[model samples]
Target: MLYWFLKWVAIGPLLRVIFRPKAYGVDHVPAEGPAILASNHLSYADWLFMPLTLPRRVTFVAKAEYFTTPGIKGWFQKKFFSGAGQVPIDRSGADAAEGAMKSAMKILAAGELFGIYPEGTRSHDGKLYRGKTGVARLALESGAPVIPCAVVGTDVVAPTGKVFGQWTRPVVRFGPPLDFSRYEGMSNDRYILRSITDEIMYEVMRLSEQEYVDMYASKAKELTKAAKEPVEPSDATSSAKKAS
Candidate 1:
């Protein structure tokens, strides 16, 4: 299969040589069975390094747009991601969410390792952000234990918004799996979903030791962008006058 070939024969070997990834608590992963690996989103390399730490494949739900990109680069991206076993989903609207859950449930039903970034998006400033409830929803729906994972040094290796960065030793730490079977059949309960998501994020934060930001990563990025935007001279002068 393409995933195994690329992982064992191709890209995997090359990356290990370059980045020298290290992993801890790998024993926490179940030897066999369905489980969810919920990790903090720090950089693009998080996906790359996390897989290198495990024997079994960790399938993440990727944006459908990545597979549909136009041009040669898009083609390469599509091939690489597909070969890496990423599932593409629209990631829009409630319908898209439903579709993603179905896709994930299918993987779990087959007793596969499913990877998810509970933060929903990569952190812009390397701080852990609020996790989305989709992770909880998936766990509750699939009856899979959620394993909290912390990925370190990936932000430096492949920062968000940049193609790539300097090679660095990345570390992935897998924590004990969190079980939510007590909340069985309560996936529709929003409060329970939020509670479960927060519990998972707390373990990730403890492992990664990154500063906690209560806002979603996407919102944080938006606020950061807005803060960085240049203010017009007219607006500045108006503000100065108003202050006077």
Candidate 2:
């Protein structure tokens, strides 16, 4: 299969030679069976280095646009993402969340590893953000254990919003699998979902040693962008007039 070929034969070996990435606590991953690898989203490279260190293929959901774009470039993009163990999901509409949940549940039903970033989006400033409850919902619905994972230094090798970055060894760390059987059949309970998500994020924070931010990563990015935008002179003048 293209996935195995790329990981072991084509791209994997080259990355190993160049970056020499190191993995710690890999034994925490199950030898077999379904599990969720919940990790902090620091950089886009997190997916590459994290799965590279694992023996099993880890599947992550990507926006459907990546696969649906038209043209020659889109063809290659689709193939590359597919070979990298990414599946496409339409991340729009009211049913988007449900659709993603179903996709992940199907993977778990097949006894495969499903990778998720509970933060929902990559951190803009390398700080761990509040994890969304979808991860908790997935674990409870699928009856799969969650493995807290942390990948450090990926931002150095592939910084967000940049094409490429300096080479540096990235470290992937895995913590013990979190079992949520106690909350079985309670996935619909929003309070329980939030509690479970927070527990998982706590472990991720410990493993990554990154500052924890109570805000969502997407919101944090938005606020940061808003802060950077220069205020219009008219707006400034209006504000001054109102103050006077």
Candidate 3:
């Protein structure tokens, strides 16, 4: 109820008036059924604009800390995210992946739309990163089709690592549903998972027209951070200078 109110009545109309997001290929989404809407992660605003363009409510798992924070701010944060169709999940530790999969499977089982960023994390840069195989496993395990989606210009609306960005119209595009029934019951096969994930990423790349990076987004971010850190002089260098 809050979800509908926020989307159609409260926040949705305001966003529409301001940003005027456009959507294409929305017909690709099933009217009523379980489906994975696999998309590239460019910016945090991707979730807002993509779902705003759709009639159906799209649910995505967010870090539990968003809902668990203390005090008055946390209460509003929890309600806002919940109204925005986000569910909180603990994203820490080795079991995080399994926990997210279970949550997603439950949503699919209930015949609801489940949104996932196959890249696992938002791209620090605008390029599309290689997708993780969890999306493939979800599709295979849930017997649901995977719809490749791309949201463009969200980075302009809300740039990564920034609070807000200049207003610009965002475009959401949906590609045809990818049916992997041929690989049914083979979700455990690492090779098959890679194949399916790659196929989905290819579609996203095509729709978004972003450069494709073979590395995971998180790994890319780590590399970028490492590059920016100051390097210390080696002990050998210091000794040689002192001796000289």
Candidate 4:
């Protein structure tokens, strides 16, 4: 009840105006039942903005920190995020993945919309990367369908920097849900999970139209940074001018 109140009466109205997000293939989202929204993650704005564009209340498994800050602001943040139906998962280490998937399965089993970014984290370079298998495992375990999604232009809105940066009109495209019903009875097969996971990632790549790297986007980002590094100058600018 609190979630829908904010979704329609408050946050939804405000974000629709501020972000003015554009959406495609919205009809692909099932009006009922459990479905997963799998997309390429490009910016922090993806979380706040994507749900605003959807008709149904979509829940994300958020990092526990969003709920644990100290004092009034923290109190407000926790309530706001919770009222929006977010699931809190500890993201401190290896256990974080296990914890997040556990929550994801719970949401899906309840016949609700579960939104996940299979790339795992925000894409530093705005490109589609290999997806983790958790999405597949969740769907297979819970008998849910996967809706591939793509969000564009938000990276520019909130790029990595001191500045919050400026808002650019963003576009979110929801591609049709690709059914993995073939794996319905074969959930125990790891190969089936991998195949289904890859299928979803392929659709995401097409929708986002980002450069596809076989490696995780996070790793590609590291290589990208390494390759673009500026060489140190042979003549050190740091040294004071010679007192000749």
Candidate 5:
């Protein structure tokens, strides 16, 4: 299959040689059966390096745009993403979040590893942000143990904007599986979901040793972009006129 070929022959081998990612607690990964690999999304390479370090295939719920772009670059992106065990789902509709959860749940029901970034998006400032509760919902719905994962130094390897950049050895650490069996059947409870998500993120913070930001990563990016935008002279004039 394309996955094996890419993993053993094409990309994975090359990445391992170049980046030389060092992974710890790989044994914590279940040798078989279903589980959630919930990780901090540091950079685009987080998906690549994490799976490259594991023998078991990890299926990530990726955005449909990764597979639907037009052009030669789009072709390659689709191929590479597919080869990396990514499944694309339309993440724009109102049910987008539920759609992603269904895809992951299907993978878990079939007794496979489901990888997810609970942070929803990569951290722009390298601080671990508050995780979305979808991951907790997945764990509860599928009755799978959640393993907290920390991928360090990947941001240096492939930063936010650049496709590839300065090489830095990344380290991946897998914390013990978290069991939320006590909170079974409480997936519909928003408070319970928040608590479960926060607990998993706490473990991820300990493993990655990164600063924790209570806000969501996407919100932080929006705030940063807004702050950087120049105040237009037209807007300034309009404000002055209103004051007058």
Candidate 6:
């Protein structure tokens, strides 16, 4: 398969060597069965470095646009993402979240590790943003344990919108999996959704050790503005409001 071949014989070895990531609590990941890796999205580098640190094939739901375009870049995106096992999900409608959640559930149902950034988008300020309920929803519905992960130094290695930056080594830490079995059979409840999402974000915050920001990272702060302030939360809406 392309995935295994890439990991064992191609990209994976080179990535691990170049990234030289520092991992903590990797043992927290389940050795077998389906599970969800809930992580903070810090930068483009997070996409490159996180899964390399993991032994299993971890698949993230990438924007569908990445799979379509009109040039060499598009071709490369399709080839690499497909080879790396990422699924493309359209995030352009009210049902986008639900569709992505369904796709994630399908992965779990097939007994695979699914990666999700509960924050929904990259954090412009490297702060842990409020988490969307999709991760919680998937966990509730699919019975997958949620592992909290953080990729430090990504914001530095390749901060958003920079196009390119220094290839400094990044740090990746995997916290103990948060068991949501207690909330089993409670999917579709807003309160339960908020609670589980918050719980996962709390662990992410601890791992990243960044200030908490309740707003969507792209809001309140201009991702292209080139200036960022470290704060707990801003005037932006909650993750649920912003993500869905």
TM-score for every candidate vs. truth? 0.89, 0.93, 0.95, 0.84, 0.90, 0.83
lDDT of 5 by residue, 1-244 (tens): 8999999899888998988899999999999999999999989888889998899999998878899999999999999888889988746446889879888988999999999999999999899999999999999999999999999999998899988778799999999999999999999999999999999999999999999999999899999999999977798799999999
Give me the candidate number with maximum TM-score.
Answer: 3
> What are the RMSDs of all candidates, in order?
2.9, 2.5, 1.8, 4.5, 2.9, 9.0
lDDT of each: 0.90, 0.93, 0.93, 0.83, 0.92, 0.83
Backbone clash total, candidate 2: 0
Kindly give the stretch of ten consecutive residues in candidate 1 with the minimal lDDT sum: 90-99
What ranges in model 1 sit over 4 Å off? 68-78, 90-94, 232-244
- For residues 1-244, write the lDDT of model 6, one tens digit per residue: 8888877689877877877788888899988899999888888777668888878889887768778866999998888888887887745446778668767877898899999988888887667778888888899999889999998888877888897777778888998878889988899799999999998999999988999978766663665464454546544656656778
Candidate 5's TM-score: 0.90
Candidate 3 has its poorest 10 consecutive residues by lDDT at 87-96
Local accuracy of candidate 2 as per-residue lDDT tens digits, 71-155: 9999999999999999886454457777788779889999999999999988989899999999999999999999999999999
Residue-level lDDT of model 4, residues 183-229, one tens digit each, is 78777788887888899999998898888877887788788889899
Worst 10 residues of 6 by lDDT: 226-235
Candidate 3 local Cα displacement, residue 108, angstroms: 0.7
Error of 4 at 229 (Å): 6.3
Tens-digit per-residue lDDT, 108-132, candidate 3 = 9999999999999898889999999
Query: In candidate 3, how many Å is residue 27 off?
Result: 0.7
Residue range with the least summed lDDT across 10 consecutive positions in model 5: 87-96
In candidate 6, position 77 carries an lDDT of: 82
Candidate 3: regions farther than 4 A off = 90-94
On a 0 to 1 TM-score scale, where does candidate 6 land against the true structure?
0.83
lDDT, candidate 1, equals 0.90
- Model 3 earns a TM-score of 0.95
1-244 per-residue lDDT for model 1 (tens digits):
8899999999899999988898999999998899999999888778878988899998877778889999999999998898897988746447877778877888899999999898987888889999999999999989999999999999888887898788789999999989999999999999999999999999999999999988898898899899999976798799999999
